[model samples]
Target: MAKDHTDPIKDLRHNTAQPFEAARAMPPSVYMSDSFLNEELTHIFSKDWFCVGRADSLAEPGDYTTCELAGQPIIVIRDRDGALRAMSNVCLHRMSTLLHGRGKTRAIVCPYHAWTYNLDGSLRGAPGMTRNTGFCKDAYHLPEIRCEEWLGWVFICLNEDTPPVAEQLADVEDLVAGYDMTNYTETFFEEHVWDTNWKVLAENFMESYHLPVCHAGTIGGLSKLEDMVCPPGLPAFNYHTILKDDQLRIAMAHPSNDRLKGDERRTTFLLAIYPSLMITLTPGYFWYLSLHPKGPGQVHIRFGGGMSDDYAGDEDAQSNFEALKTLLDDVNVEDRGCTEKVYRGLCSDHAVPGHLSHLERPNYDFAQYLMARLEEGRAD
Candidate 1:
């Protein structure tokens, strides 16, 4: 349990229950305390189904990617049987990390002692353990982790009892049905270490309140506060809708699809899947961020997205993708500056919670989610 220096859990409980008009931001200690971060790693991230990357990226049977979640190294791979598998990346022989990064591998061989395992996590060979009596290689396979495929994305949970991703995200699937997201190809993917708390980035992506001020030169002109719609939070996710008076800049520059009609052509949806998945959907493009806490003040961000098949197959796709990537890069620069400064302010001795704006309803719901997870931890 986290030491109660500022009673943030109490504050979270109180403020999260208030009406939107009277709601308050979470306390700074929630973002600045190492103890609280450790608690979050155990109670929130580890126990939830967290997205890692697009399953489509591992199209081939032997493709794999390595990542760290809750300080535990993980390997997500597509086996020779075309099944997606997740397992502890630690070599069973000497506890060394088996894989360093993304690649195609026929077998996961521990460099330390040459102990080899098949892609399905079954032990294939042990270099010198044959001489030992009573040694059972069958019982020495790499430990498997809970993994699931939702839409076209890959999600893993450390806790075996966590609910299935499909069950939790059923409503979200309906909400985004028109987009045909499963067919969307990933044209861009990158990992970045940002100097901000994971929640800060999650909150930033969940609301459009900062668009006009923080993204003024880029996406700001396309937004109007009156047109924004903030929906109540769900048990598994929270979302807000942004109505554009005109087509998005990229949409205007490329061919539009007939599949989307009316407001779907001009509406944008920003959704935060509790704990760490943030997705933004527009008519022509979609992008997302999967956040992982590195410490109290650092977050590892997996950022990527791509155009819908309709637009991706367009003749102008190469040029439009370049333009869209440039625009997103600029927007990210603006966001990084603001979030880093906010983190610095959070460390101040005089830091305190402030009343939230109506546009920040998503942030309020996020507070609720955090409180619910903390309470669950206490119960356990």
Candidate 2:
């Protein structure tokens, strides 16, 4: 039996504190503990810039998508003024959630009651409330959440104190400037619940070491494991690029694209944005995973992928994206199995964290990021 300890994850700091050559995986307790999950919810998720989806997806007025952060339910929508906005999804009157999923709505109506709210989240109608002198519709505007767009990706921050997304991710923008990532068109976006700690899936994405084995049936054959580069990570994010073979045409820069020369034209950047946004960006396409914890045992994931505009005029662009999406789906299936198995193994009393490989440098940095957030939580 595992002995109860005051801080099972305190060793996580120690493990991550070591040099990269000697770094170790975080203690398994970090993934299995309810207390740590609560701390992470209060500290990290509550204050981070969460990518809702691509801004272009909700381009027209009345278009909206609903999501939750930490424990707060939010609705990201285009209002009457054609502005992207984020507001509480919960009705002000009876507190029932206002929206269920992505769709167009001129007004948000609480299913539990007839209370209706305009696209701007201002209360429009309250049936049978005329008798209630205390009720003021004008005073019942749904509280707004902070929303921003960075490179066409929509992000929302619950903490008003956090810096703007673009300002924070400016360097990331600079690094991938050659790709014109904003021009990419989203092809698919879906949500799923995976039976694993969120961090397990995140770390899986952070390293390429597992690709040859875990993803062998899908992308494993394509990964240039020897050439992948994972230098020390930047504070806001971490990335490793794999050199694409000449045979993979779409992964390379287009003939029209002169911005990326030499190896930059053939490298695929796998970026891990902190607090759970994992992205794989190539010259011709991109995919991402935005994660949220259902609890200590499960993770809620938003999976999306798209094609670069370089292929916009090509007759085969749709077919290429379809194939890419299928391959990505297979990759996701492999990842799910690996991460879930890792989580299940973590429950064993004999399970112990092992040393990290050189390729897992991002995983080490990720651990550092987590501890940093936890300390910030403590300070507050």
- The candidate scoring highest on lDDT is 2
Model 1 C-alpha lDDT per residue in residues 145-199, reported as the tens digit of each score: 9999998989999998888999999999999887767877788889999999999
Predicted model with the maximum TM-score: 2
lDDT of 2: 0.89
Tens digits of per-residue lDDT, candidate 2, 52-92, equal 88987888999999998999999999999988999999988
Q: What total of clashing residue pairs does each candidate reach?
A: 0, 0
In model 1, the Cα lDDT at residue 21 comes to 83
Q: For candidate 1, what is the lDDT? A: 0.85
Q: What pairs collide in candidate 2?
A: none
Query: TM-score of predicted model 2?
Result: 0.97
Cα misplacement distance, residue 67 of candidate 1 (Å): 1.6
